[model samples]
Target: MTTLLEPVLSVRQVLTLERVLAGEPEVVAGAGQLDRPVRWVHVAEAADVGVMLSGGEMVLTTGVLLAGDDELQAEYIRSLHRAEAAAVVLGLGRAFPAPPDVMRRAAERCGLPMVVLHRPFPFAELTEEVQSRLVRRKFAAVSLSEAVRTALTGLITADAPLQRLLDEIAQHSGCPVVVTNLAHRVLATAGERPAVDDVLRDWERISRQAGRGEGDGWIRAELGGRGERWGGILLCGYRGDAATGRLLADRAAEALVLHRMLGGGSAHSWEEQSAQSLLTDLIGGVVPARQLLPRARAAGLPVNRRTFVPLVVRDGDPGRLDRILRLLGMPGLVAELTGRSTAVLLSLARDQDAEALAAHFAARLRTETAPGTVVAAADGRIAWDDVPAGLREAQHVAEAVADSAAVLDLPPVVRLRDVHLRGLIRLLRDDPQVQSFAERELHGLLREADEDLLSVLRTYLATGRNKSRTAQLHHVSRPALYRRLEAIRTRLGVDLDDFEQAASVHIALLAHDAQQR
Candidate 1:
């Protein structure tokens, strides 16, 4: 069975000399000075005993050599003070009948704690007792460090998630554990007392403050692998001593780095993963922009210093896009969204134009996918905080472009304006009025046994009401096409020849298709 020692085993505890020595010790001087830590215990009878002490020691002596010599005793006390000893214990008996007045006055003036033993005390026994306790505390600290390392390493080897590892660390350390990217975004947290949000609510301020201090209440260690730093782990309100906290942080960091390294993929791939997660979150709009800053930076995104160009490519091959990105030496995150669409957060130089960049990506993507691929770039370059809005805009454009049919003059870089009518319809697809209008207009055709008449109308509208082309495309006689048109007009209560009416019906159709998609 293993037993845990007191968590706090500071050098200061040895100041309780009576308990340590098992004899009543008289405080001859410096009563208020006993608060200093006794790092070790040393016994000396030599006159120049101060030379042997490095400091933080409670020196014990019988004073057998300097009996009744005021000058030598005062000098000895002064030397101990100069050496920064914790306290001085004068063993009574042969040394003197009682504590010397001159040495006591000097000690009092110097504020060096002086204790006089009232009875004969075995110096060796005191040394053994204090040293044993100190040694036990050292071993206990080593045990705790090993215990923490083993627990975290075990979890890492078992394929535990990052949050689970942090949870274990927090459980052992009894404090909140936070993992963040270089940009200072909170990635995961565990054992957050009072709530995780409370710890992260002011992360910016807290991080800045913690950065300026040295192990005050918070401790941190960098998480790195493959010579590239991923981020860091932070512990708030750590209860252990500074040394132990550092050890724990180091072990946790090592485990975290190793876990990432062994999880499959390289640093570049992990960088993409990080970016993909951040971009997905931005598109989702679930997490705040400020919260994503650190992750963006740590993921090799210039969140602080560079402009971001949000881009989306629909119905394109992701592998081709990834290869193109690698060839261009552009670092960005690419995530496969729902369907055939993919989202990208491209980091651009501050002076680069979003249009030029988008055009470059579009040209390469179109070459890869061939025939056609809709590439939508956000209106302009934006700050990291504004990237989410850009993502939304780019996604809107991509969806609109995908639903469009007669975009004959396609620009390399499509935007909201490029999508025109189709863009507006896609945006409003979910609006109550749009849905009601689509249902009301297309209700008859939607209820048909077959979509023959619907296809005819679609071909006719797509051909700008050109009877010849519509009939030829549908492989039907002009009269047959006319009949289908008549059926459409009757069902929708509109004339296909009227421009305004045809435009309305076309928009409704586009919205219906977009909704289906």
Candidate 2:
């Protein structure tokens, strides 16, 4: 869960009434949310009760409802107020010279969404608008619970590969599927396979074009990226259901984050299984990342900050994640489980920056998911070959493997990519460059040599050119080490004697292998 339910904007809610009434915005304190559309108009023929309306509801009268006495004119205007109408419009030729001034003053007391119309508005449009809003509301409710169940299902068992998952999700949602970073870089894609690498590139275009006050299905939401994290959003969908998109997008975001989290985080077996099941089920079928956005809008809710970095939650009632999203901007905290028992999470306040986001996620995980539930956050922003950079991808590698392993031992969601490196190494070995380097440059070193080699190089470079101690620790005869040194020089094609070359080799070689491993 990555979002907190924001206060429903009353202005827009009122306009819903206006559009239904076929009324114009005569007056609105906060014009931003209103000034546009409404679905309900109070058409009352009673006394001028238009003043009673709260606002944004048009009052319709035929004057027949108050046709008789001059003394009762003021009473008629009062009725619009009773209906809480937006504005009162005297149907032309209905009453004598319109109700007395005394009645209009009373109508002015309350700021109503009253509008006078020269003609009777079509009521069919109102009905349709009301039905549309209702439909939206219904979907919103469905999406909320659906998000929870889906999160659990993603944690369930699955045999599909990453491409299959993306395909299914896109088919269901009727939109493109993309996995992005805080920088809006597309790490992977599902629907628009033809443009897989364009995810980030497109994000750049959409982010620049997004604007506020546009209440279309297409929207820009902020995901927390303060610190070393990825924050982004699903820009648009064909249906333009912003409300539905919020619910669906958050689930997808959580799934990705939890999927990433499981590689290194802690989660119980049951929790892990549930999350995978939902993810598999959701993506395995036709699923759209923005499926729930429309529903959110109908519920009179506002979605802020599209990028909700997910925290993976497992067996632990991933519902907590959904709840956390609702609580995020409210009380300043949120959390969830993406793939069932695989991972749990929390989203902090937007003002809280990167370090704060990470810190809050860690602290909240300790409070909710379990003590020490949050282990580490890996971001693609790190140097592609650096350990810190690979940490993020490694976690996902672990997740993909764990998802496969989930078919057995009740499965575990805490995936560590290194566990699968052996298989990958075998695959990459087909490349002669990789094979030769492993056989020659890294030869004589144990299987675990890669890990220590990087560490040793890092430390060795830190110590300057110190051969005697380097040989002593390598546990080698100094002369024998010298012979090996000459061998290293031959394979590496650089002089260890050159200060710059030594440092460069250490970083370039180790960092490169670390990423692949």
Candidate 3:
């Protein structure tokens, strides 16, 4: 079985080894500093050997050169401290056969750990054992780093999605992986379902408290390029040393940055995709809503005991809608749907007025965006199971008004009641009987491909068959309009003066237009 390897050994861990324990080592000073990392083990006998050392090395000595001079012993300890050595192990056979107060006091003052072996121990055995272990660990760490790098690069080359990359990282780190924007909104996640959900349930608090470095088992690395930071990737609750976790996080960050640069997506695009996936699944209803409750919660949507308002906007921009939600301090999910429409699912408190909030959203959309933007909404639902039908109803309403929004005096938010006959036609547009009726009723004009007559008829019927209004709107004289209406009547074999005949043609035209859309 493969296990994670720590790159460096702490001084305390080094002392507990069986080979080092054979010497009966006892900590005489700086016991509180025993957790310091030891990079290597060195055996130096010279009194001024501190100059020949780098930091984090455990220096082993017999103290033979400083046996007679107390000042020299103190200076030696000070020199090792200045060199930033991890600790000093003194074999006390010839050098006073006991712990020296001068050196111990100096080490304690400098906060450098000092150990003394109380037996005849060979420094070579301890050094060989530790050195080999360190070498093996270092090699393992390098191997792990390379393994992660190769796996990530291979996935990138295969054109894997962002979630796949995160999953790969999570598998290697044995923890949940999260990608977030600068504001700490989680854009993507991968790992065990329950584990990822647990992380996301309290993500805001955790993100605020986590630094952009290793903390406990949480390691974070910035995801950006060209000297601009846009987001970050985190390894949450990793069960490994800081060094190993850091290596994993840094490698993952590099892969993520490259993925984004190689057209994986921007942070906003990733968020949009996430919303799209969830909303698509919700609307599709292939999976039951109860089965998707965990997903909704993990996506940062408040689902418990909240009123859900399902809305669809015709020709709406998802980005602008998301911004409006943020500006209003409303929690919602926005995503672009098919047919140039966008879906916005708002999670509101039970006390709030869903209709008013949806109207407010529509008002803001009209004010900040296009004045004719049509927002269609369904009745607010208090249960999660009702949301799918609500979304479908809103979509139906939006589609019903898509072609006639400019002419209809729709409220800020259009609902099913507001759509009337048009909504029914839209719902039945796909029916074979409706399609055949529309084709047969409009066959003459459709076959002619004369858009001028069709437009005149559409405007005339839309205006309650007001001939004067149709003539004026079409910029034609009454005589010319009469001739066109006569031509339309002759082609469709219907009487323009008869109300029932005109209504039948009007319904056919609406159904035809709906089908075309």
Candidate 4:
């Protein structure tokens, strides 16, 4: 309708589009001089072409939108051109002339893309270009918003994660992709790298050097003006084009907004905060690296590079590790323990990748722990300038794995450790759906409760069958504690004294921490 937002368009965008019509021109606008500062494309059936346009969009016509004469044809073309139509394709064999002189003059006047689709031209070819143009014209933020919408819907409705949506976008570009925050911290990534789970490992060491930057194919993008601020980098491999960068930035902004709304100090910290919260309490940190390494090595991570790092824990936090591995494109499996917590085990193809990721995990753990309390490893020696956030993600993944396993499942998990409990926690925690029942029922409480119910449960568990003690620790009384515990048992349908059932509740609480971290 009415807005302050502007659309971005480029000529090359035409090639990446879907078919607009059956006989549309497979027109290729290589000049890349299409009108910018556009709004959106719409099919207007109104008689006056100019009046119908909201701006942007290459209007497709059989020349029916224009009812003007020879002189008016030029005027009409000029009118559409002035409205900033990126391009105008007039299909031949329609009422409009094959080579309308008026369009030529207007093209010269406004420099808008003007093409006359010859009769019988396959619209499929033309549609791809149109789709490409339309996609590029979009605000990358909007595209990511769409992705977020789809991902969230999929997360709840079809059971998917943001990673799948990101993978889809990366697949579209046919290159490795790094999605970052507004400050350029990578939150998620896809495609091959020197190693698994090393997103900006050791960024504080290298990235601190002003503008050494992360990820290849990501050049410094000037958004124009002070306070213009970088939206973040979008790396493109060989198949990546300039549009991919713009789209990545858009997605970056959208993701930033989503994470910010998730609760953080600012746009930059939102991704980190949300991720920290999501993986924080998973017993064994997330990663399926062991299962994934063979493939990553197959791709080039470990050909002659036998060097490795161990994500040590007695067992692993599969969900936490899964998030990390999912982010890293690493793979592993989760397993459940009969008498212990879940666990996970994975490996990075290279050594430095392991070290860098270890650093990220360490920092996140500091927020909730004492120093040297947690350990995760990464080892890869690639160009340090590559994706710093990836490294950080690797770090956090290591933390999730090491901490989760030690605290909840087993003591001290390792890539090669007998951390079956850690591994089982990871395997069992892999399915957040198990907690979906609590999540839905607890929605009303999360919105209304003055205290965090999850915290209450944890505190109560710590008190060891002593309601008064737990209440005192929580700054509440026995009555309040009892009331809350009853609600939890009722909502969750489990008893604290029933050792097997109570353990599931503990895991659910851990899972909640996993989601937030």
Estimate every model's Cα lDDT from 0 to 1.
0.75, 0.43, 0.88, 0.47
lDDT of 3 by residue, 115-177 (tens): 999988999999999999888878988999999999999999999999899999999999999
Residue pairs in collision within model 3: none
User: lDDT, candidate 3, residue 122?
Assistant: 91
> For candidate 4, lDDT tens digit of each residue in 1-517?
2232234444435423434334455443313464243334444434367876766666666666554566666776677766767677667765754666665665666667666666555544555655555456455645654664565444334433445544655554455554444444444555654422343343333223324645444433322223555344344442434444545545444543343344423433324333432223222335433333333332222224333333332233434544554565553322232222322223345544554554554444344444334443333323322222223333444434543332233222123234333334444455757558436534434545534666677656534456776677678877777898887777566678787776656555555554544
Clashes of each: 3, 111, 0, 96
Candidate achieving higher TM-score, 1 or 2: 1
Model 4 lDDT at residue 501: 70
Question: How far out, in Å, is residue 372 in model 1?
Answer: 3.0
- The list of candidate 3 runs beyond 4 A from truth reads 1-6, 11-35, 45-50, 60-82, 87-126, 137-161, 164-168, 212-214, 224-228, 258-265, 285-308, 326-331, 347-353, 368-371, 381-389, 424-517
- Report the CA-based lDDT of candidate 3 relative to the real structure: 0.88
Candidate ranking under lDDT, highest first, comes to: 3, 1, 4, 2
lDDT tens digits by residue: candidate 1, 1-517: 1123323223335546455546667788998876565667899877778898887788989989778788988899989988888888888896787888998999999999888888788888888878887677678778988898888888878887666787888888788887776766566667854544556555666677656655465888887766878778888768766656767778888877887777834344544454566678888889888776655554445555567788888887666777888788776767777787888778877777756777888887777675567888886556666888999999888887674333235788788887778788888889998999988778878865637887777767766788998888778899988888888888878988999989888877887878878
Sort order, TM-score high to low: 3, 1, 2, 4
TM-score of each: 0.60, 0.34, 0.74, 0.33
The local lDDT score (0 to 100) that residue 217 gets in candidate 3 is: 83
lDDT of 2 by residue, 57-128 (tens): 544565665556655655665554564443444544546334335545555654433333344556455546
Off by over 4 Å in 1: 1-239, 242-270, 280-295, 304-306, 315-340, 381-385, 404-409, 444-502
